[model samples]
Target: MHPPGADTVLVRHGDLNTKSNTVKRYMEGLLAENLEAILADRSVPGEVERRWSRPLVHTTEDAVEDATAAAADTFGVVSASPCLTTSTEKDRILEVLAETARARYDGGSFAVDARRADKSLPYDSDDLAREGGAAIWEAVADEFEPEVDLDDPDLTFGVEVREDVAFVYLEKRAGPGGLPLGAQEPVIAMVSGGIDSPVAAYEAMKRGSPIVPVYVDLGPFGGIDHEARAMETVRVLSGYAPNFDMEVYRVPGGETISVLVEEMEEGRMLSMRRFFYRAAEVLAERVDAHGIVTGEAVGQKSSQTVQNLGVTSRATRLPIHRPLLTRDKADIVEQAREIGTFTESTIDAGCNRVAPDRAETNARLEPLLAAEPDDLFERAEEAARNAKLVEP
Candidate 1:
């Protein structure tokens, strides 16, 4: 068994920022108070390396072993191993092969999985695979003992080097990298036919919280056809969250919205959204959902403005989850793409189609609340009561 406090790092292919963020969120959710201690005074700093897309970061095998141990204690960590990635510096590709050999012979048997994004890498994938195999054999030499087998090793070394950093990590640790679990027991998401909401749902699911997707269909804005498209979008979302169930909340908001608009100004549209959230809260309680989720990204739109989100949030007594609240638009899109919801989200159009140009961002709560008519609250309650829930 590997000694305690072994420093192991994870090297995954693709975007480093996402991997880092995912790790941080998972750690925070799982470790809770301990996470603050881990980050505030990261005794395991050098234990985790960010090398673009590559799996291995240390130039020496000893360093890899040390990092592996420290990573194991980062909290919420099940297993920790080091990985080395190489998408750049095609010339040094053989070195990665050599390092893998060193790691294997040092202890476990390992296998190599190939990903060739940079066609210009010194050797084509097949050539590299063969060369890597040869290098492993050469490094092991006659020192190979009966106890260690080349073909079936315990460790699975991975390499993904994209852009500038050549990330290196062993397969032992794997990833605590999924969306967080149990931050909120259950929540609702105002999943529209858009990228943000799907990403939001995904984040909530990562937290291990059950999600109830609610879509509002302002018929004239986009009727049953749009509603059907939203349902199709749910089908796509299901792929990422196979174990989770999605419930579609369909609201025929045309008549209600028109009446609300005539009585209240454009700013009141946000208040109207709050009513919908309250409706979701009621449904959530019915289904034993502990909280609500929404695709509200900070500074993404008028309704997503701090004030608007706050106002809408007040309608719900349960916790409201905003997974995308602090993320950038580009980052959110990338996550949507990765989760396979990008294509479907882009195809669905909803209320934003006819949304007023001047949607408020930094709205003052007192003013907006004071401006809302009393009947508006009654209408919201009624609409929420009359809302329909579809299960998929």
Candidate 2:
């Protein structure tokens, strides 16, 4: 139990499989704003703080109790309770209000904001509001003396239920969450004109790491196909963040790798990665970004093995931040779902087109560096310098 000034209980809406980082980010974003509110008043002390996710994790009764405990824990909290009313169904909302209202003592007024995210739900929005409000009144009337009017009730509660989740909170403060702002300096993404890199760029932006997306338009990977994908992805991402910028680096590496593949000993994956990082570094230095961010997940495939990661990492002095590094396929899929990137990336093109069927997983650094064709790095640098600067 917490002694509370302002208790906040975060609720997990559904089985969306949202990452802890994203949730944490959203909560922080909310708290930062709410804390400022408390601070401005100078009446609430110790500031607004959040407890761990509770409502969604616990059963209905337990979630309520947990919320109460968190609120109570705050230093200056007068009293706290997890709001017990939230639902996409108006009937459910009314049912919850009628059911939970019995717990309310005298001197408390309640409000219902019937928020509807799913238009397909059975009832109209207004119907939900009226029924829900009526339910609370009925519950109060049945359980205790009817306070003539709710205008001056001792406590005020609110309910917000939408598609996939509901939030019942006494207070709605802003969240500290935005993209993890300023974690990494701006970097130019490989922007494969494919799904992964664009999605990766979006993830990078959310973290507050500025991006200079670098799309390598080889002109041979089906002309308008690559360019169209790159342009469209940047457009969607820019909608989320207006101030984004991009640079299209045209590397003829796709064709070059095809020719080189014949000369290598089944290590084409490593060779391709080498070219990618090298090209990326040239752009990174040009833009002054500290490191490159990629969508690579470790061991999801052969090319992501420990040895492959090590070899690819060697191509640049700047650190590579693989946000998806340890994520499983399911986790990555879920993230893509949240950002609207999954479908787009998948439909654009496949990554393994040029990769070997069974690329070397345990690439030795000495042989990997020593094996490749000459002037690959030099060609990459020149190509990066000429990549297009697309506005996000």
Candidate 3:
């Protein structure tokens, strides 16, 4: 029903139907601002204009492809479709429909769905659908089959006749629906270049929290390739937020680990993890972020055991959000793949070292308390301040 090349992209609110009219309009604007921010980053030319009170972004044909893909990832967007903007005249509509059909109609079974929003039009919705379907069939029947199925067809063409202009579309792509990025609260995501952490960062982003990544440099345990991997993972996460570039804080993790090794003969792992939490808190304060996000799944690692997790929690005052706390590794792996981090996560970089023997699975708070080092929080703050900004 639409022209061959799509010039307009449709963006729908994630949960507009659940909101009141006023809230719906606000959500629409919020989605637009976020998407506009996305396009602005690319320097792509376009305007997000509403059509018939619906969010339909208008972009030049040259930029439509990039805009469509970016719009699909922006939070708060439910579905996006590339559409042709045309006049409401019947002849004009049929002419473009026929031309598009001749170019793309594969002589296959297809159906037309038409809605006349401009009630001023004489014809009803069903009449326009039947008429448009018949026109497409007549125009392309010479080269292809023209079987029309009202129920289920190989292809479904759409036409919406609004007061000012009509829109035609062939496909609708799914978007990650939630509040827009920065809508909730900002969080510092502790990324380890492993599978679970970046995925946890993604979950926070999906819930509308902008992410500031903090990568702890464990020194000789992880080499240059290890740092590169961590940066790459942050870059991967940045793809989700086109409008905002995610920053990585390369905290001097070696200092904390070295201190734990020198000061604590027992519960060193737990002490090291507590250092991680303290680093997260420092980074969050520096960036004005409200909390910390981690991919620490329960029982997944010795440091992640319930008791050990509790011991680590005491290190930070800010709220710690463990998005993958209860999620299974299989589920996390599937999500990592979905978010394009699975390949990078699987790379066996030298940074991920083997654990020492007697890895404390049930790190007790009492032991950790006894082995605590002096200037622990002060060293953590210093490490945060000395962190270098790394880019992929």
List the candidates' TM-scores in order.
0.57, 0.57, 0.83
Clashing pairs in 3: 107-144, 107-145, 222-351
Where is model 1 more than 4 Å wrong at Cα?
1-176, 179-184
lDDT of 1: 0.59
Q: Mind giving the per-residue lDDT tens digits that candidate 1 earns over 273-352?
A: 77667767766766787777888777778787777787777776888878788999999899777667787677646666
Runs of candidate 2 with Cα error greater than 4 angstroms are: 1-184, 193-195, 218-223, 246-252, 348-351
Candidate No. with top TM-score: 3
Worst 10 residues of 3 by lDDT: 347-356
Compared with the true structure, what per-residue lDDT tens digits does model 2 show for residues 313-360? 888888887877777777667766665666655644434555666678
CA-lDDT, candidates in order: 0.59, 0.56, 0.78
Cα TM-score of candidate 3: 0.83
